[model samples]
Target: MPAHVPDLTALTLLVAVARTTSLAEAARELDLSVQAASARIRSVERRLGAPVLQRGRQGRRSSRLTARGALLVEWAGPVLDAARDLDAAVTALRPPQPDADPVVLAVAPTVAEHLLPGWLVHLRAGPGGEVALLGGDATLDDPAGDPAGAVRDGAAAVGVVETGTALAGLHATTVATDDLVLVVSPGHPWAGGPGVDAAELAATPQITRRPGGGARGALADALAEAVPGVAPAAPVCELATDAAVRAAVRADAGPAVLPRLAVAADLATGALTEVAVHGLQTRREFRAVWPEGTSLRGTARDLLRIATGGRLR
Candidate 1:
């Protein structure tokens, strides 16, 4: 033993894996790669001088915790619970500001990482004036859960999501557009070609986001309509983050459907080439949503105005 406390983050990961019973699922929830998760677990085990988990078969399923691992989870649970309580207590002790509402926005990982920073800068520079921006991740299968649901349930003042259809009980304003493009490394066969047809695209294995994601849904809907009998090829790799998908495509893993915003730099630098797919509609609208019938006021209204470029839909 090193005579020091275990890392809080490592302990949290252990609990996540123990509950999910799958290393990949835990990694996805924690926004980590499987390799990274494995490393963290290994480090924790090394510190304890005991194996905490039994590895599972590759490409099949998640690993299970050892009896000692279960014991670690039991010890960690109360520490985590106390930490949460401390956080809440600290938040409750903060003085309330009369001028600012501290607007919290929930958004998907792609927008949060790539698009929201610019928007935040613009909003702060505009008439909103010293607005406090609190951001939350609402990526698919996120440990914190869905962004749209967060807004709908009033946990957040607004949510920016990628969708073509309106969510029930919410007022959706189309704030921006993201075009999903089929991309490949510059050396891949699809590069500089006339592009693939619907059937050909359907039959090609590609890197992709996990199912149930906004991008995945848009792709599925477009493919189902355009090529009735054909289904998309099995994913060569499925990841929770667009960055991972882009990285895979850049490494020549396979052709991937990725947001233009995500691959813009790569396309500009000629590191990746965009391929057109005939008869496929790849554009998905990014909408700012809030509970319907609730009138926007104060900072919330100002944020909505800023997000939609002075237009509210």
Candidate 2:
């Protein structure tokens, strides 16, 4: 380790002086004041203990490289070329940065509550990059607060929702599956016996989620397919959240259909009973969605990957 190695600026200034044949001209080309460029040369000479320039007869304005300066210029050529190469390599190797603004994630209630926490934890611990996420309810962008609509409208960069239906104007992929089960308090009559028929279930007034919710929409679609021309019976109660619906059902409000993920513990502990529904398909898909034309990258892509359990799509 030498005490005073000439820096890149000094070396570059020397090369420029060699090419321009005048210290003032080289300084001008490099956007440095003549005094500053002269100081750089002096600094280099002090470090190297050698003269690197020859002053011409023209009032010390014109310059020429000394024997040592000519050798230095030749040596500095490769070093300078390598420096340029190193700079370009560094620029090429650098990763493209994600948008500075936090990526907005709109999520449906069930997925947001039951699944998002773990996914976000994984995202934080994983290798992708910084996860600057702003999480919100699926309704963030749309007046209706529909996750699909929020994504399509560009209100959110990504969305996680539970649904079995196709979303127009958006690209979606299944991340998980949930069964919408008909559940009641342990004391309800449906808790003990034979499965209810699809038609009978459709006609029974039950506690349910609000119309726009995923479970409610999925249940409606399934019932419509199972019993065509007969609309579902109006709800005895319409709740805004899964917890509310579950609490109401636990208190014997009415039998309500809900995602099993929301009530699995209650079902296992016999706090609630899952009544069978004959001829009805309650299986629904939980999906990650984004606007059709856009490609997910950076943290957005990383979140999608984690949600899909490490599968990159």
* Per-model CA lDDT versus the true structure: 0.75, 0.77
The residue-level lDDT of candidate 2 at 161 comes to 67
The top-ranked prediction according to lDDT is 2
Q: Residue 55 in model 1: shift from native, Å?
A: 62
Q: How do the residues 29-95 of candidate 1 rate in per-residue lDDT, one tens digit apiece?
A: 9999999988888888888897888755663324788888899999888677655544433342344
> How many clashing residue pairs, candidate 2?
1
Per-structure clash totals for the candidates: 0, 1
- In angstroms, the error of model 1 at 194 is 0.9
Candidate 2: regions farther than 4 A off: 1-100, 127-144, 161-170, 291-294
TM-scores, all models, native as reference: 0.61, 0.60
lDDT of 2 at 52: 82
